[model samples]
Target: MRSIITISREFGSGGREIGKKLADDLGIPFYDKELLEMASKESGICQELFVKNDESYTNSFLFSLVMGNYPVSADGRINPDMPLNHKIFLAQFETIKNIAKKGPCVIVGRCADYVLKNEPNIIDFFISGNTAEKKKRILERYDIEKNKAEDFIRKTDKRRASYYNYYTDMKWGEAKNYDLCINSSKTGVDGAIKLMKAYIEIKEANADK
Candidate 1:
């Protein structure tokens, strides 16, 4: 049914874990860092470079040129004159679209919600938590002292927001931007997934009617 789930998450909200579990439960492919690899392979760029520059803003023309926006030769290599970042952005954009076209899959981060905003079967969710809960999660996962967790969360979420804001017109973590704005601290990770599944099913049933 062309189900594409896009999850936008706060730092340490366990959204990635939820996405993986959801995909496993639904028996569908899950995409996260793997998307970067696929995009790199498809665009003929170095995988490490792709991951480094992936979703990263580029003001440099050279960076944009290597990314492949220029016309390709008969052999599919980008023309010599194009900016790398532009090329990479276009390639990644196309890759994301292609993945979505394949049907139901879970995509985490990378402004995927905005990418698939127009798709009828797409369900966009934003997972967030109270500051204390988020900090605790980060501290435990990274094995950091509690005092450092707040700063880490702030910096991480700021980077995510910057990345998302640069690529899309929508604001990151805005409730209105998503179909479901879940507070993971309240629902917990598994509960959030269950709620998301139920929400999707209800929406689909209503659409069918």
Candidate 2:
């Protein structure tokens, strides 16, 4: 309960629900889309921009060239002339760090694991499920037709993977990058939550020793 937890989940994996429930059970704050609001407030940027770019990456060569020459302020403020996408990213990055500094909480997606990688009390998790189960889950949760669920799931996962890979040195959904990897298809949502809680207990106990 003393460790900040960051969850990177595949589409239709139930990762957000697990993170929210776990945080509630542990009496800690939960952050997912809420991070966007915080970053908007912190950076004086519009929240709509963050929502538009949420968990998505842009690969514009021109923007990269421009950002390279963009001068950062001596006080470490983001350059106003930087691309909106990069500004939104930096805002979220700083917001994640500030949230971690506040206390232990559960954060879902948006490359929070990489944002807080150097923190002493951070636990990172990657949640994934088998393709069939994920598609079924997606069909149940969203209004999409059963025939299209698979494609929807695939596209969503691809977008998330691209975003994570673009921002972090680690590969998305790679086991070595996370402290624990949960297969929600095998364990179910409640089971996964239980496993995470037990792991947290052991980690905190070991840290105390």
Candidate 3:
């Protein structure tokens, strides 16, 4: 009930839905796309840039070499010359920390688990589903052909994995990296949320003792 929850989810896995509902039921704030807006405002960067780079990282080594690392000078100010992608990430990193300071909330994706790794009251979850279930979910939510849904899901998950793996030392979807790994296909969204709530309650109670 008093933990900052971070959810890393596979494409079409109902992760965002679970995070929002969990926050609502717990009377805490939920952040997903809303984090992008806050990042834009905080960094004075265009919102479009954050959306474009959100949850996906650049894979080209040459491009990264040209852009250089996300740098902070001795004064602790981010270098003006840092790449746009890095800038967006830094913005999100700062925004996530700022949001956590406000209180317990559910944050979805964006390597939030890594960003807040050192912060207290952190609980991370990874949500995944079987390929068939994910494809069905994608087909229903998006106006795409049934034949293309599987490919779409595969590509989207690849991008997310690349993003997360690039940002954090831990592998995405790895069971050990998360406090709990839920297969939404088996339990469904409501069941997954219930499980998370139960886990958080137990964790909080143990902490108090």
Query: lDDT of each prediction vs. the true structure?
Result: 0.82, 0.87, 0.87
Q: Give all candidate RMSDs, comma-separated.
A: 3.8, 3.1, 3.4
Model 2 lDDT tens row, 1-209 = 68999999999999998899989999999999999999999999999999999988885322232235434777876567777777777788779989999999999998888778779999999999999989987888889988889889999999999888876667999999999999999999999999999999999999999
Residue-wise lDDT of candidate 3 within 100-196, one digit each (tens)? 9998999999888887787779999999999998998898899999999999999999999888887667799999999999999999999999999
**TM-score between candidate 1 and the true structure:** 0.86
Better of 1 and 2 by lDDT: 2
Q: For model 3, which pairs clash?
A: none
Candidate 1 segments exceeding 4 Å error: 59-80, 143-145
The TM-score values for the models, in the order shown, are 0.86, 0.91, 0.92
Q: Give the CA lDDT, 0 to 100, for residue 16 in model 1.
A: 91
Clashes of each: 17, 0, 0
What count of clashes does model 1 give? 17
Model 2 pairs whose backbones collide: none
> Which regions of candidate 2 deviate over 4 angstroms?
59-71
